[model samples]
Target: MTTSTTGGRTTVADTQNPPGATGGRGRSARKRRAILDAAREVFLRGGYLGTNMDEIAALSEVSKQTVYKHFGSKEALFVEIVTSMTSGAGDTVHDQLPQPARGDDLAQYLREYAYRQLTVVLTPDLMRLRRLVIGEVPRFPELARVLHEGGPARAMRSMAALFERLADEGRLTVDDPRTAASHFNWLVMAEPVNRAMLLGDEAIPSPQELRRHAADGVRVFLAAYGPGAGHAPR
Candidate 1:
């Protein structure tokens, strides 16, 4: 764990996992998280081209060689950062959704889910991350793929499952739940995220704005596909 940034070594204690456990597995996981967190900050500030392993190591307080040992290369580290961020962001929200599709509570569940999504995007660090990915995407197509897998695609997959369950219960009449999920997400995020990305961090919408979006999305979804939608198989 002794590496060369900021006049210190990134000891095992610096990791997220608590100190001392069975074997050294817990310590390694902690070290990985520390490295990932440091890499995220570095990537956000420097972009892909500006990022360097030595600098990341220094920022992480792990040695230069230690950075190499953990991530192998700058590109790998960037991918890891994107993967982690995307996982927590888009996918995690869907995972929190009710598995069986509580039709009665659908509105409330969607509202909460929308709020979590908005919170993730509006956070200062995550906002910078989205910008950074967009900026580097043209030059690095892999970044786009990673973002897709971690973000929209992941969310859609989860949403499709939920929608399929709803359809089975005759709460929704979705023929292609995946497409419907994608469309719903677009309706929810298009305006606010577009503005935030364009205006940098300064354009993040207020909580009231997010609440409105959530309400509208839920209303539209229910109107289009909910129980009374005639499309539901009689």
Candidate 2:
């Protein structure tokens, strides 16, 4: 590498990659991504018990040794995929839920939030994940608890914090924001989420159906939590 000073500004010149530098880190990262992507696809199709490391390796176009080096085990890869669902392996997770009250109309905010929530939760990836959990949970009941506590429960806590904020702002009256959050979640999610879980990937609700669900849930939620509903704030 060389630098020249011109007009009191330093300019970089003749910068180049060192010989024998094969971009090891970038290649490793791409391999890891391929493994995760392949793992997600295989698990979604085969469930945790049925998926194997060789198939994942083959699908990823990486060697079995490479897959083992990257992920260590099938269970480890499965856990990573499951955890990433909540923590955002993608863009859909965070934006699906509402942030703390931001001066939007309560009804409109709730509707939009619920609709996005439904949209995300009802996706093929999540629905397949839910089915995988169901299939695995009977033999490993602890996995059920792990999935619930890690994924949906985390979302509930976030929503509860939003409800608490709404209560503080006098946008809603709520004695128990956790319960309020649960109510709102179940109101919008129960039927559609369950249907997709039990039926198949094709069981997702239509956009019009989702809109109606969100609107109805907002109406019911506001009826209880709206100002002057007068349950006497605790």
Candidate 3:
């Protein structure tokens, strides 16, 4: 929930210029990376339906044929970018939720996972993609579904598993972790995330503010179903 873990920035850093006389193959690879970066920017701005390869090629300073050679189609390019943006963080989110052990700390694990997820969700480009999906959902429902499956839905599954494991370990009493995880997420991102996306990131919440929201969500969640809640693990 805190900005400490929020991936607020998504700026792809420029690779250092190769020391005198970069080779042709190396140059081509660099160009490919540039193309991917440009494609990401374009997709974030234009969404799937609105983006075109020509603009991406122009932004990447490559010929249209080069773009086609690299990705083949707009959907392919968008899928690749979505995979890149969402998958890496998915791994991190899973890693944050280590398997629950006897006497393992549940609140601590939730806090860590919540913090990491908050960071990933708040990442500017991902945030833009979230907005794009919402705006385009009426027209392109599949795109929204794909993004959800790739992004938030995956995150929810990871959290759900963690919650289920906790219940198994007698740390919580969750009969349906999918619903529980969804509630947990809504609580964590309830304030800052919605404001960030709705306000178009015009006002980035402070780290302190983000942390406060996360902490509050954790507190309330624990009070509801954590350690002392009736229904003990069977």
Task: Output the lDDT of residue 202, model 1.
Answer: 75
lDDT of 1 by residue, 74-164 (tens): 8788888887887777655766655544546777877777777777767887778778887887777887787778776777787788788
Across 1-234, the per-residue lDDT of candidate 2 in tens digits comes to 788899999866534545534577679999999999999999888887789999999999999999989878887888888877745622364454546446677799788878887888788888888778787776667767767876667667867888888888888898998999899889888988889888987788899989998999999989988988887756
- How many clashes would you count in candidate 2? 0
lDDT of 3 at 185: 80
User: Model 1 — TM-score against the truth?
Assistant: 0.81
What value of lDDT does candidate 2 attain over all alpha carbons? 0.81
By lDDT, who's the top model here?
Answer: 2
How many backbone clashes can be found in candidate 3?
3
Best by TM-score: 2
- The parts of candidate 3 lying over 4 Å away from their true place are 1-31, 46-50, 96-104
Could you tell which candidate, 1 or 3, scores higher by TM-score? 1
Tens digits of per-residue lDDT, candidate 3, 61-111, equal 999899888788877787678767777667776765566567756677677
List the candidate numbers ranked by TM-score, top first: 2, 1, 3
TM-score of each: 0.81, 0.85, 0.77
In order of listing, the candidates' clash counts read 3, 0, 3
- Is 2 or 3 the stronger prediction by lDDT? 2
Pitting candidate 1 against candidate 2, the one with the higher TM-score is 2
Off by over 4 Å in 1: 1-28, 100-103, 232-234
